[model samples]
Target: MTAAPTPPSPPPRRDAGRPRGATIVAAVLAAVRAELAETGFEGLSVERVARRAEVNKTSVYRRWPTREALVAAAMEGLLEEFGASPDTGSLRGDLHALAAPIAELAARPDGVALLRAALATTAPGDVRGAARQRVGPPVASASSIVDRARARGEWRDGADPQQAVFTLVGAIVHRTLLEHADPTGEWLDGLVDLVHRGVSADPPP
Candidate 1:
């Protein structure tokens, strides 16, 4: 029998190569990250970020009213898009799962760069506030997981779901962004252990 014709190659992705919104965001973020890694906060500026993103000054300014706003928007987008939520059955497992990407991001070049930039500024305001608020959805999503666990009696009725989410995120932020230290899985596990000790009730024999 004649050999079957080879299947046609898949169509190239249309959006993959374009300079669309995602591209703009990615380019600006990468540029900002690079600058932050090199110069820390003093180096980050609207003009610099715009040049790096390869977009005009108008585009950057229109989207972000200020330097802080730009930085916050970039950070919020990065965290929302790349970070995974905790969902394993046990709290420890869920925490570990959440921490894995965080540890990896903390150790990444871009992540280090972004952290440096974020540290230089006071808390975000105005446009920055809007961007920071974007975190609400993901934060709520993470909280729901913990709440479900609590409902199942896997966790104590008094468990603070919000605290659990923050603790997990904060550990990674502290190690990678603030301390400028490489985040290790062991370190993440330590964080989980600490939270567990604080929150978990002793299981009956």
Candidate 2:
């Protein structure tokens, strides 16, 4: 009969109807960082992160699959927040510009704690890989500075670009974590000057 016509089916669920993955990912990562900052990695858990993020546990698992992976992702976000590379047109200026912000980040207790937690839990290779990613932009910036210096005959062509980057960063990290020293303006300036002198192609007139 005409009265027996079937009712129309409901519309299919679409990804467009759900929260954007980027938003969810940001929230989750933020939560992970917060957890790390508050409780350190030893106290971290999927449930705690899920609660903090207000997302399902399954969602966190789907994305990160493990606590270490989640922490790595959060640490990666922290590195990204360090901002872009500096290009002040000279090697010294670039080093000065880059050193200030990195020192500032190292000064933050939460930032240092997060770094420690990641180092404690994650594999050394993985940590190094993440570090490479974190430092990639700054290294490239330093390389550009090196290139400019070479063009101007301020630096030798055979200088190692990576060594230049590591020198400043490694020293900052050492003083921050080991010596318990502030990476103050005076310290940073001296560090830059020292590195510049060591790497310069010719003695300053």
Candidate 3:
């Protein structure tokens, strides 16, 4: 009888003992943020990110084919880490809470650099679209605060939610980017109070 054919070898487990996919993604993202913090967007590179993350460049390219996409993803992650919006049962308190973190971030040199670089490097449409999504949660929180204030008859009806939210954020951005000034706690409190007064004064529909 002919000798039995040798049994086929089992397929190699290429990913055996490797970190999970989600873990790898998180590592890459963390590396992206670290790179941005340390070097800003102009200095960011896929190879550097891969080295920092201890991940393969191919993996990053596979997920984010372009630098713009990677930057957008990194910014989105950063925004999410800002945590949930505050609901202190009053509009003024909520605005203060919202402005506090922004002011804190603006106070950091690295944070200011990151924001400026992101704004300067990203294409206009890409940055605006991605920023809108990234900022959506906080905007929603602001809207909720407005709704609560309206319910309590503290805020005017027909107040523009978008304008109200942006008023607070715009002040922080102006201080951080245009003036290159660190926002004092006193300044933040005054900003919230001013926006509250403006919104409160809107004529009712």
Candidate 4:
């Protein structure tokens, strides 16, 4: 007589074999950032990304379908993160809030590497454009920040919003990469103060 074998555990249910969507997306996006940080867009390899993500290449392809898509997905969170200005009720406080995160990122090894990678290229293609496409144009957020400051009588007469943001970004880059300095409390506070003076209603002497 033969014994029953539990029918193979009901074939493990229909969708059990499918990869978890959230987990898979997170892994793929993280892998995308890592690959982009290391190789920029030109050197990005699907195989390497898949290997790093611990996912099948098919999974990445099926979801993203292209390097641009992967980069876009990877940068989505950053889009939201750097897009909003906190209303701390003061221009100086708002500027500090805005610049704090970026400066903090520059202080980290992985972050500084990624920051360098962000400008590693200037060509038409590569991660440079993809990054710009995703993270920018940051003008909207900057404009809103300045507008708020203006309403509070804190904005300078002719200060450019884009230029203000650029200055902050440049200072952070120079401090972290060229100067090899930590963008810590005192340094960040000084940075905010400097930019605030430039962006405030006082003329430079």
Candidate 5:
């Protein structure tokens, strides 16, 4: 009998040699956030994100196939610095530190657009939460800042950590996105002072 003919080999995967690790994850997530800010949720496309990330579309699809999943993954890495507010040693200091960067971000056009994407009522749930994480994290998901403050007996009567955080972030977003004003350092200080007083167990100085 004649020997069976050899079978043809399957084609290699498009990302066969691509490095799949933190580097790829970081690039992909970064691309998704930039995409969300510029093009927004409605305009976001896997192809564009892949191109910006310099990775194969297959790679992104393999990790985050759905819009919700992609946005959630993007959020997982966003504003991570804000997640852990270091021991500023006082509630006022902590609040100031936390508010400063958010204010700074709001001052930029990209930041304004980015905030618009997050605060959009029509955006998917996860995308909305990502921008809110600037303050949200300090309350639940991210840090010990609130816990530390509570332990120090710093919070005033009926002042909830969640609400306190929301208030601080909300002011920044309103000023930068709605008012279309720069979140100047001077302004941030004033905002922090106001929020600090509202939440502090002691009265404002």
Candidate 6:
């Protein structure tokens, strides 16, 4: 029987030097993170990030479209700094687990500097809108720990998860970014206790 017409072979994937596209993205992100660590967000620029990353500004702008977009992307690199909040089943434990990373970062000069820079600058281009897209997942995960605690009858029904998240997190941001002081675990522990007492359904015996 005549062989069925062979289906045309799929076109071979073209290299088009596109393999480096992902690498470039990674490099640029790394550069931004490095700059934030060293100089803070205030010192960041597309050119600076590109220079640190060993890439050209054109490539960075082309990939990100705007400075804000790039900043948002850079902030995303901090994902590793954020961790899953502990479900220790105690409000204090849960809050401490959530706040510890933030406190640690706030205490670090690099982290504090970057955050200060981020807060000081006007968001470039579509960056403000893109920020929630980038930081939201981490924020949501952290907040979920609180939600779980509430479900367990640990926290009061009036507790606002988003507000709580921001309140606790904002304290770190304030000390690190604005106050320009070292944040300590002892301080963080106290803050956690304060927040827990405010939200706990039952007062500590």
Give candidate 2's error at residue 166 in angstroms. 0.7
What does candidate 3's lDDT look like per residue over 168-188, in tens digits?
A: 878887887778677857888
Output the worst ten-in-a-row residue range by lDDT, candidate 1. 123-132
Find the candidate with the highest TM-score and give its number: 4
* Per-structure clash totals for the candidates: 0, 0, 0, 0, 1, 1
lDDT (10s digit) by residue, model 6, range 1-205: 8889989985532212466777788878877766765765456677787776777677888888876677677666553655566677777777777777767766764454346444545555344444334334446765677678767878787877777778787888777755767666677777778787787787557
Evaluate model 2: give its lDDT: 0.71
Where does candidate 5 have its weakest 10-residue lDDT segment?
A: 134-143
Candidate 5 deviant stretches above 4 angstroms:
1-22, 83-91, 104-118, 126-135, 140-163, 179-184, 197-205
lDDT for predicted candidate 5 compared with the true structure: 0.73
Worst 10 residues of 2 by lDDT: 11-20
Q: How do all models score by TM-score?
A: 0.64, 0.65, 0.66, 0.69, 0.64, 0.66
Q: Indicate whether candidate 4 or candidate 6 has the larger lDDT.
A: 4
- On the 0 to 100 scale, the lDDT of residue 59 in model 2 is 80
TM-score of 6: 0.66
lDDT of 2 by residue, 1-205 (tens): 4578788996532222476598778888888777765666677788988877777788889889987688778777555655555567776786788677777877775456555564554445564365356645656667667777777777865677789778988888788767878876789899999888777787557
After aligning candidate 3 to the native by TM-score, how far in Å is the CA of 166 from where it should be?
Answer: 1.1
CA displacement after TM-score superposition, residue 37 of candidate 5 (Å): 1.3
Candidate closest to the true structure, highest lDDT: 5
Q: Which candidate would rank higher by lDDT, 1 or 5?
A: 5
- At residue 163, candidate 1 shows an lDDT of 87
**After aligning candidate 5 to the native by TM-score, how far in Å is the CA of 57 from where it should be?**
3.2
lDDT of 1 by residue, 1-205 (tens): 9999999996543224565677776677677666766666566677777776677777777667777666666565545554446567786776666566656766887666555644455434443344335434445666656765676666766778788777876777787766878687667778878877766766757
Candidate 2, residue 88: CA error in Å? Answer: 2.6
Local accuracy by lDDT, each model: 0.65, 0.71, 0.72, 0.72, 0.73, 0.67
The runs of at least 3 residues in candidate 6 whose Cα sits more than 4 Å from the true structure, single-residue gaps closed, are 1-23, 36-43, 80-84, 105-121, 137-153, 157-159, 202-205
